[model samples]
Target: MGGSGFLGGELVRRSVMDGRVVAATYLSRPGAAAGADWLPLDVRDRTAVAALIGEFGPDIVVNAAFRQSDWVTTAMGAAHVAVATSENGGRLVHVSSDAVFSGKAVTYTENCVPDPITPYGAAKAAAETAVQAIDPTAVIARTSLIVGDGGSPHEDLVRSLATGGRNGVLFTDDVRCPVHVRDLSAALLELANSDRAGIHHVAGADAVSRYELGCLIARRDGFDPARLPFGRRADTDLPGPVDVRLDCGLTQRHLRTRLRGAREFVK
Candidate 1:
């Protein structure tokens, strides 16, 4: 539903490139989605969600709208979208995050139970539970750090760290399987068109530490990787490194689409 955001924007662009009739939804920004039919939607408002869904009567709905600061928009709003999509008999592909899992596990399968350690993780877990309860046929695609050609928030943050725009150390111990934006968007579109229901891990093919990812980006983008210092979770009082390495073998086998790793896209 968030056509303005990174992954959402890519979906819109790719849909248009594929010659699909697209109606994108935005929360506060209108011009964020350049092409396609733009619709102002506040998912937190249940009535607004229903009205939009009824009028549009979309065949497939992808819930990409999320906010970390606002629980109402992130969790409850997802629930609203799921319920509305279910009521309309529309196929739903909800975007979830790897944050739903605790870092205790080295690798997480699709069947891994969610045990979030952070508030954002907890909210995402709640959203997944709510979506499944409301619509059993909904596809919950849990992804890791999203990176691509166009600037994403995660990529921007890494750039800031490399350029000294942001004063934060990258974690060397933290591990994640970052999926390219195009690959992820394509996978979501495929799942949206299919009848596949239940949780699925749609992430990168390779796992790497956050420090390695940041350094890769810095070197590729002509920034000094040495400017970015590394932070060890074991040495600090802060919450330790989280290893959200998802096993995307099921996704690789299910769909013909190939999920490229961060190494391929960093450059």
Candidate 2:
């Protein structure tokens, strides 16, 4: 695994559970988990990245090291991983996002053209482009807002809602298909172990709005659903794309993991 973040950390555990020799990396907490040989290396340093890949000699490389600071770090980081894996002849499994789509009244499928608007989306789109350019066999797993037990987008959003003064804001308009971290991790592992190639839409069973999600979380955790702050997708400064619902038909047909909806974690 190239990273040990939310999804990457779970992927590492699953990879080890599947009896695979995992070499995990992290920026700060290298020893966060005990399943893999934690290697402390920064993705920004191409030489160190190359050295790690050359040393580990993994049969398959997962480019999951991501940063939200600059576009170069977010976009070009995937390119560096692709470069490191180029000489090794290993298949690169790159994780992408639904943000790659413009979210302009279209339910994006595996075949949809990428048209990202946000810097994060654009970076992921760029990373996807880099991987496709370097290795056609690389699995670009495009997904939506991820949620699970530990650190993830949902957790952050939940904390924000739970402690947002008195209002506890939420948007009832914007929609997304949030896949659980466990399911996404399993799907990634299955894809890496299979011969399935090209871009695949691995997402939740159904789509729901952020407001509805917040409502569920609030209700589940003893917070009044009515007391929670509610708003529309347009309320936020996040540019274009209110709802980028993913088309997971291909993944549902191919992969072994069962990717469920966001409500699975509400309890």
Candidate 3:
């Protein structure tokens, strides 16, 4: 585990213990947790990352760090980590994004090759390809909008509505299989321990829309029901497939644990 991001943080906390020493690092966490040995280092800096690799001696490495959370930066970061992890004799699990899908269909399986429609999606798709090329044993866990507690955008919207920032919110008509960060973290670790390295769709239980998901979050958190009304979605223009919801059947059957459903994740 390299990043202490929302999902990444949970993964490290669970996976690292007496038998496992988590090499958790962060550039600037503002404040580090008491138990975590959070380091100040950048993954793009090969030497620093390599030094951490040598010190931790981890059996498995999960590249949950996304560079600038965009295309070029993310791809390069993933490529660098894959190289370091493979050369260091550690298994690699790279977190990928569903933006890689063209969003042309309702759902995508592990079978769907990525046809990225956005810069972020392109980076992730490229990163997946590069990681696979270097080490076919590396696992690529492709996930969508990771929703959870701890000040996420989903939660922010509720806050905004509470303070009356806006009367109606504009949600995308786009459909996605949003996974809860915590459950997804568990699923990835299960895949890692199993040594089952390949492409897998790590998504939530339902194929839902942005509007539906927003309403669900609001309802679950007990936000004002009347103020959160159905809003319109922006028509995004791009050059590839769109709205490809992921089908995680392969993940369901392969891993030891059954991933939580969309509703379960929301809760």
* Stretches > 4 Å off in candidate 1: 239-241
Model 3 TM-score on a 0 to 1 scale? 0.88
Worst-scoring 10-residue span by lDDT in model 1: 232-241
Which candidate has the top score in lDDT? 1
| Per-prediction TM-score | 0.95, 0.92, 0.88
- 1 or 2, greater by lDDT: 1
| lDDT digits (tens) for residues 1-267 of candidate 3 | 446677767776676543466667776672243355677767777776778787777688888887545554588778877888888899888999887888766578898878776677788888999999989998899987788863466667655664578675635566778777777888888777786888988988787776677767777777765666555444544243435678998788886666666666665
Write down the lDDT that model 2 would get: 0.79
Selected candidate, larger lDDT, 2 vs 3: 2
**Candidate 3 residue pairs that clash:** 102-241, 102-242, 103-241, 103-242, 103-243, 103-244, 104-242, 106-245, 107-245, 108-245
Off by over 4 Å in 2: 163-168
Q: What would the C-alpha RMSD of candidate 3 be, to one decimal place?
A: 2.6
lDDT, candidates in the order shown:
0.88, 0.79, 0.74
Ten residues in a row with the worst lDDT in model 3?
Answer: 233-242
Clashing residue pairs in all predictions, respectively, total: 0, 4, 10
For candidate 1, write residues 1-267 as lDDT tens digits.
999888999999988888888889998885455568999999999999999998889888899999987888889999999989989988899999998888888799999999987778888889999999999999999999998863877678778988788888878888999999999999999988786899999999879888999888888878898998789776678653377799999877888789998888888
